[model samples]
Target: MDNTANPAFDVTKRLRATSPKSVAIHEEAARVMAAEIVGTVEIACPVYIESASGSRLTDVDGKEYIDLTMGFGPHVLGHRPASVEKALAEQITRGWHWGIHNPLQHRLGELLLEAAPCGEQVVFCNTGTEATMYAIRAARAFTGKSVVAVFDGSYHGVHDYALLVAERSSDRRNPAPRRRGAGIPSEILETVAMLPYNDEAAFDIIRENRDRLAAVLVEPVQSSNPRTDIGPWLRELAKVCREAGVLLIVDEVITGFRLAYGGGQEYFDVDADLATYGKALGGGLPIGAVAGRTDVMSVFNTGSERARPIFSGGTFSGNPLTMAAGIAALTEMRDTPDLYPRLNGLGDRLAEAINRHARQHKMPVTMMNAGSMFHLRFAEGQIRSSRDITSRYVKAEHVFYQHLQECGVLVPGIHLAFVSAAHSEADIDAVAAAVTASLDTLRNDGMI
Candidate 1:
């Protein structure tokens, strides 16, 4: 463990325990999870949701919350959406799993291809983690390079390569891959090269490793706390990957569909060799997909001798129920012509309002946004790379979240939030007001 990250505050020591439903559930989780799991020690505000609807949640204590977490950005159409609900109903009437190819998977795949401009072929999977794992393997098979590079602070689920984070040092010379947890093998980290997100130096990193690099995977935008738009950098990444003969893979698991119907590709205006999607595309079901140009994607084509070793065998890969839900979700996002612009406007308003409130109250916090994606950072400088997101960014007056939760609003697990098509002007206003209230209370207590 790095002493730099082991700041006095990031280390969590409970002052006391309680019997609240949220506390009880967390206690149980602590008991079941290994001590090595960060969740077992580090803590956040409470949430014991009993039920959720469009953009709102009700906890077991009967308190309502305007849900900005949106189940980690998956419920873009909002929780328990009628379209997905109806689709699940239809699937229930038909069947669950058949352990073979089904029509629904074919239909959803076609739908994904149609929505996906850079995509010529598609492969279904159960989760974003699986989608990324297979996509990297596919890129390696096609390009014959053993190494892949992912940006720092970019979340790519649980994978050996993406688990690495940049070393906590300002000097470029000190940069090294730091493992996420203790058990990840050093050999695995050796295969991966870490780059600072949105840094111009990415060109240097890729150029230096061009011979060994199979792919350069990136999130078009790092939407975690303090959302930073990486549009121009994405264009550069696309250009470099083509010139270097290294495949570019966009890990759009979080940004897909929420930002635009076609995901990060549509927003960034640069085509990657492959893109992975899960969150909003699944429409509340457990689904993920990797799509790419036929040349690179054909490695997965059935009956191809070259494709035999690139295995992605998940029993729930193309389950009918999940396909049904995805079909409905994609259709909703596509059919509604105005949803994209409308959600973007609301997100803009939310960011603007939150920033205004934070500034007026002398809180050194800033909210940023890209379409419906938004997050806050406590740092005052320009956030360009993953290294820029320091402890000051996350270790803000978290009592704001606690107060917001009390006042019926839910942000992300950290300093993040998302807007959905289900969010309306009133909903946005309510969240804005909650932000003001939370800040006001903090200011009164001399905490801001």
Candidate 2:
């Protein structure tokens, strides 16, 4: 390949521009920042990216790499997608904030309602955290219940209610919902319950608290689950909720928009009382929303007299720029025929290559996927829940992703990888080659 020409497919040129700055900022961040940044983030040896475009990120050191992280799974359309970028630029010309509601949020929310599984109402928010927060509130308001149930190992943002962690206390991993990162109040956590994922006993767990249970929230697929087809499990859980007369709030923040235009609810062929979406919905910006049946949302519309359980307020919740970008992104996705299947196919190819390579090397590993969101579990056995995500899957080989980073590909860790609209056939192949080479290095060094 000639160096003079810019490969539309590769972002090497952009990557080359930010290498120095990436290192410098990180070094300085460690010197001045808190311990958490150093222990978990900086020590991970990640590059500080300067710029990004479809399927690529340029680090401060001026190195370009294929980004599998997608900024922690937001850029489903991939970085700086032309449609999203153009919409933002156009919004800037009009004005950044309209102060009163802009049509952007409404338009974006409309798309969500249309695409959602038979839902016609929506409440826009600014982030996934808020989406879950308000969705819980809505469920509580509608059902007159105080407690909510979430799955262990499934992330519903860092909200106090969702901070519950399951630990192996004795025979089974029991949930210990600690004020883990701090600042969360004990009173707030009272309303949340954590349960095992993919386990059939979820109903039994919820049955004890059925009277207080407002909703059952779960991710259709565990982003960190070592296996797939979690949709079926979620559908079963939804049935359990319905049988008990409790609301089902499908937390689709990570699984949404990416799995399909309508989100995991539609893809799974299930109906939810409420659902949340973010990350991919923004196209590449900050955007989130709660969508579901009209009865559940009536609480929000009943006025302050009702004192609706879901109280939401934010200055930029429905800002013009985000809405415009969201609209454009949704429009582009909608117009394209079978865009989601294309993404799923892309992930299928990459997953196949990785698994096949592992088999050939006689390496004990497993790969799982949901549309474009994919993960590689180092364990070869059946992974039914968070307990199944063993150290072998995330310990040493997880760190070995750094080598894959150096090989010019980006994935969050050994745990999760994302394929976006911008990811090309060549990009997938290159990432597969990087994974193979990276694992080879680990094997040769006895690092695996």
lDDT, each prediction? 0.77, 0.76
Judged by lDDT against the true structure, how good is candidate 2?
A: 0.76
The per-prediction CA RMSD against the true structure, in angstroms, equals: 4.6, 6.2
Off by over 4 Å in 1: 1-19, 25-45, 170-174, 225-229, 305-308, 392-395
Model 2: per-residue Cα lDDT over 1-448, one tens digit each: 7655422212333333335566567678778867533132422454776899889888767778898988788787888989889888988999987659876667788888888884678888889999998988888877888988887777888778877666556234335554556788878768887776777767687766789899988887777773456667777888888888888888788877778877777788877888888887887778778888877787777464566445677888888888888888888988988788899999999889988998889876666777688877777666676676566545446545666666888766334779888999999999889988877766765655
lDDT of 1 by residue, 219-332 (tens): 877766335366787898899889988999988898888778887788778788899988777788888899989888877776776735476778888899888898999998
TM-score attained by model 1? 0.90
Per-prediction TM-score: 0.90, 0.90
Model 2 ranges off by over 4 Å: 1-20, 35-44, 170-179, 302-309, 392-395, 413-415
Leading candidate by TM-score? 1
Error of 1 at 89 (Å): 0.7
The whole-model C-alpha lDDT of candidate 1 against the native structure comes to 0.77
